[model samples]
Target: MPMPATALQEQLITAVRQNDAAAITRLLAEGADANAPDGRGFTPLVLAAYDDHLEATRALLAGGADPNRPVGGGNTVLMGVAFKGHTGMAQLLLDHGAELNARNGEGSTALMFAVLFGRHEFLDLLLAAGADATLRDNKGQSARDLARQKGNDHALTVLPE
Candidate 1:
């Protein structure tokens, strides 16, 4: 049988989903698992970053959230933040040791997503964080290729030459 969700785990997930930084802090202080994955394979930090909750992201990161942990579709917290055009959040995760070149199940990295979505600021942030511009996805498309295909000249310029 599948294991049931522990009360603390459920509470932690709830606090993150609701963007309650205080509740998350209290739970962590009381020994909650900061890296625990919910049903969707997303840790609290992943959800907070995806939801653009900078405070919650900061709290979880401070409490030791695994920035490299992959969630639904094999995307990491950095990927979610970058894809959503949250440059500040992306930079924060990068500074906290997020792998800039991390690839998803389909081999798409955060840089590729940023360019494909026309998030120039995020693309710049990812590049500055040392994401490999030459890295290709499952379809063999690099971030530059995606940017060119989408007519995102600003994103194209952010890529390494």
Candidate 2:
């Protein structure tokens, strides 16, 4: 049988949910697995990214969480950062080796998410970081296609046609 979650693991998950950087630090120091996923496969890093908790995301990354790990729905932490328009968090993940072209379950890249969500500020950052503008999602929609569909003409100005 799979072993149950340790007390520290539970607390670490809780700390991440609460955005308690201090508690997360203590838990990591006390030997919690920074990469441990909760019931839904959400690691602390994923949770932090989803919530736009920059400091907590940084701490988890520092603690060795995999930036590429899919946190359910085939979404990476970087995708969450893009969805939330957290350019700094996305930059931090890139610096730590996040795959700029990593696709989620739907084959949608973080660049696609940025365009789909109308996060104009993230477009340049993602492009400069090397996201593939020509990449297609499961629906065969490129980031530019999504932008066109969303009527984000400003994004069209920069994304490939």
Cα-based lDDT for every prediction: 0.85, 0.86
Say which candidate scores most in lDDT.
2
- What is candidate 2's lDDT per residue for 5-119, written digit by digit as tens? 5888998888888888888898888889999888777788988887878778878888888999887888888898888999888888999999999998899999988888989
- Angstrom error of the Cα, residue 133, model 1: value is 0.5
- Which residue pairs in candidate 1 have backbone atoms (N, alpha carbon, C) closer than 3 angstroms, thus clashing? none
Best candidate, TM-score? 2
| lDDT of each residue in 1-161, candidate 1, tens digit only | 53244877898888888888898898888778899888767788988898988888888998989999888889888888876899888888888999989999999999888888888878877777677999999999988888889999997666766
Give the TM-score of each candidate: 0.89, 0.90
Residue 57 of model 2, lDDT score: 81
